[model samples]
Target chain A: MNIYLRLVYRNIRANLDRASLFFELIFPLFFIFVQGFGLNGIVPPFDVGNGRVISYSLFLAAGAVTLTVINGGTNAGTQLWFDRKNGMFEQLLMGPFTRAQYILSIIFATLIIGVAGSLLVFGFAFPVLGASFAPTWEGALLIAGALFLGTMFFGAFAIALSVVLKSSETFQIVSTFAFFIFLFTSSVFFPASAAPSAIQAASLANPLTYTTDIFRAGLFNAVTPTVSLELGVLAIEAVAMFVIAVFAFRRIRV
Target chain B: MLMAPDQVVRVDELSRHFGDKIAVDRVSFDIARSEVFGFLGPNGAGKTTTIKMLTTLLPSTSGRATVLGHDLKTEGRKIRAQIGVVQQQDSFDQGLNVETSMDLYGLIWNVPKAERRRRIDELIGHFEMQEFRKMPTVDLSAGQRRRLQVAREFIHDMDLLFLDEPTVGLDPIVRRSVLDYLKERVRQGLTIFFTTHILEEAEYLCNRIAVINQGRIVQIDTPENLKRRFGSAKAVEFKLLQGTSSEMASALSSSASVSRFGRDEGSGAYRVTTTRPESVIPEIYRLADRLNLTVSSIYISETTLEDAFINLVTEDEKAVANGGRAS
Candidate 1:
């Protein structure tokens, strides 16, 4: 495992330049601020039981961070495909590390990116929204848990996709399809209550929906009974996806 | 466990197939400690397939093999821990710099942090990659990348090293340097199993070589033994200094000393193949003198590995053709 950690560390340090710190931190922070304030004027605020017009902008901030994590996680598999095409993947296979070690390294790197993105979102949202960003410690832990699992779940999904897809062009099409499907069906842009019954049921099945809801509940301290159930469902899906992904990846012919 | 002084690698019948195509047939061989064993074959032969199986990347279909006394099927992890493999294609992570890449590979082999740092420094100097140590691998040339790849394998002192076509695109100078480094490693008692299509590379580096064709071992012997056994035959080629009459060429072709002969249509030269070049040479000179035929150049040469390969493959093709007709 020390080897796996070192590999991940080396890769992240080298690629940190490719994913410029300015773009990763400052650009997303700027986008969240601009989009949050701009959308505030267009959509009317929601009325919670506390009688305050709740700014859904905080939800957007969380959603943006989650989006960054999702992008990084999905791109992990595409990066492996690129490596394979460029001869790097063959190198790793011939190394002393096992396939499990390789996959774990990817997952570790994704987790770091996801956590960093989430923290950056928090750093921006808490300052601008003031009292509206009041989140309990328990809620923060739950959000962190959700993001960690969500990143691994999607990252593993991408690994499975990498094994089945031969080319990056086909992988892009599949990634785009997966992205929009998760976005439209999840609670990223809207509430599950407003969605139709069948749509709500489908959202319940989508792991991203659970992740988004968990983030929303954590940031706003608005934990409904449904949130717990979604968290449970997401946990089960994360484990199942991880197992399936590892199994599928094991069968790949180096 | 450390290998006994005698054994480097040992295998019983090893086989691997992909779908309907058999990549490695029931093949087996052994290499003594400190020996450089070359797996030689043409493209698409079972060289890479067998190497992959030996390196524990691909499982054999039906076979038993051991490396340094560790069972390949059960102790693959242990075997892999002690072996280093450099694939045919460039396999280093291009995102990292040379030093970092070596450091990461060292860590993978469980080298201590201090040892890894020391080794990285040593290798960077050894490979003469200091100028490019800080640059990303994408910026390095093909030869430079190959140097890093070969250096990365030695970050930790492994008991066995497997290199697949390590000099595929390298120029002669760089190829020699890589081969010399491999030789040095062998002198340090590291068993090297490398594959290559270039026959001369095997002749230069390998103490023992096995030539595989169509998933079967066609021949296995030292370069000297192979040459003495299959490469002693000679070819005598001569070019006509002036255009000879058709009658003179036909008369030359009828000599009993000539085993086989062919005329070049464009150059109008004649080439003859014979095991006894001494007798054939005098006959050719006498015939030319008697006919007043001028000889531009007459050269007698020994057979090469390339010739042996062609002869072996052609013979195999003939056998197959005859078998088909018989069937």
Candidate 2:
């Protein structure tokens, strides 16, 4: 287990150049600002019970943070595809560790990056959008929980697809498809009620929807649907995906 | 004779097949404690496949194997704890600097912070990596990266080590230094299993070698014994005086001293194979003197490992060809 942790640490440290604050965090932060504040004039306001200008910017900010987790997890798994092509995966597989350990290390590193990126986005979003965070410490815990479980679920899914896919190009295609699916189907852009009945049903089935729903609830203390329902859905998805990913990785032929 | 229980590695009929293609066929060998065993073979000869099995990377298709007496299938994690591996390719984390890279590997092995720091410092100097210790691995040269790969494996005192073509693609001086370092570790009781196609490396480093071809072990013996058994005997070649007839070649072939004689098809030169070339040379000179044939040039060829390898492989090929023809 210590070896596995060390491996995770090494991957994060080694990839520092690829982890530029400007590109990954700052750029996404700016995009969230433009989508939130800049679009308020052209885009019509969302109707809430009170006649206050509904800050879609805050909603978009939270969505961006969730998207960052998805991006981080997908990129981490795709990097393994590059390693496999270069024979580095073969080398690691032949080393002392089991395949399960290898996958865990990758997932751990992705989780760190995802959570860190999400937190940074949260810090930037709070000030720019003038959106107040939950005053209670429970909100912070919920945010952390969302990042941790969400990244692991997506990270495991990416790893499973990576082992089955033949090349990075294919992984990229699948990732793009997954991103759009999660982005549109989940509560990233709009509330589940705004979607069609069929779309809402599909969104409820998506693990990302539950994760995003819970995170939004924690940030705004606004419950669109039952908060517990989304949390429960995410928990089951996280556990099931983790098991499948570990098993799929173990059965992979070096 | 009773074998000791402390053998570093024991393989029994280890085979791995990919679908219908048998990549590693029923190959079995063992390494005694502190011995440097060389797995020598040409490309596509199952060296990597066998190494993968030994290192617990791939499951064997049949048979049983163990490392440090722990079953490869059951106790892989424990076996992994007791061994170090240097793969053929450089696999250092490209995102980390050399120091961080080593630190992470040490951390994974659960080394204490103080011990890890001391070992990192010692290894930096020992591997001549002090200058590049702060530089990311992506910035290092091939040789520098290879040094880090080898150094990373030595952070812990492992009982067994696997080096898969560790020195492939390095200059002669660097290759020698790496091999020497491995030998030094072997002297300190580290059992090493390394794969290489360089025969001279096997000759200099290995206590015993297994020559593999087409997924099978063609021969397994000490270098000296293999040289003696399959190595070519001395041979003498002479250019016959212009117009030396085919009849003369036939006559020379029947000589008691000459095992076989043939003429070069293009040059019409006479080549003689003999067990005792020193005595046979005198006989050839005498025959030439009586026949009044002028010898234009004479050359003798010495035996080498390359000759022994070619002879062994060709002998097998010849037997296969003959069987095919008979069938």
RMSD of each: 4.5, 4.4
lDDT of 2 by residue, A1-254 (tens): 46677667755655445645347677567758776677756666564222223567766677778877787778577657756764557656655577767777888888888888888888877786776544557656667778888998988888888888877788889877987888788877777778899889989788778778678767665554466676777878888988988877776666
Question: Which regions of candidate 1 fall more than 4 Å away from where they truly are?
Answer: A14-17, A20-31, A47-53, A132-135, A196-201, B1-5, B121-131, B236-272, B276-300, B324-327
Candidate 2 regions off by >4 Å?
A: A16-22, A41-54, A82-88, A137-141, A196-201, B1-3, B112-135, B139-144, B236-253, B261-271, B276-300, B320-327
The ten-residue window of minimal lDDT in model 1 chain B covers: B318-327
lDDT of 1 by residue, A1-254 (tens): 56767768755664445564446566446646787778878877774223334666765666666776676666567666766776766666666667787778877887787677777767766677664556589788878878987888787788778778878789878987987788778777666667899878888788888887777677667677766787888889888988987887787776
TM-score of chain A of each: 0.86, 0.87
Number of backbone clashes in candidate 2 = 4
Candidate 2 chain A weakest lDDT stretch, 10 residues: A45-54
Top TM-score: which candidate number? 1
- The sequence of per-residue lDDT tens digits that candidate 1 reaches over residues B1-327 is 344569878877799988999989888888898899988777887888898898888899997888978898888878877888888877766668778877877776678889988888877877778899998888889889888888888888788889898887778887887788788878988889988888888788999888777777777888777766667468888876776556556765787767787787887777788877889888777777887887789898876776666665566557666774122
Q: Which ten residues in a row have the lowest lDDT in candidate 1 chain A?
A: A47-56
Q: What is the TM-score of each candidate against the true structure?
A: 0.86, 0.85
lDDT against true structure, model 2:
0.77
Q: Which candidate number has the best lDDT?
A: 2
Question: Tens-digit lDDT track for model 2 on B197-306?
Answer: 78788788988878877677778888788877888877888886755755557667887878888778787677899877887777767777777777778888877666
Residue pairs of candidate 1 with colliding backbone atoms: none
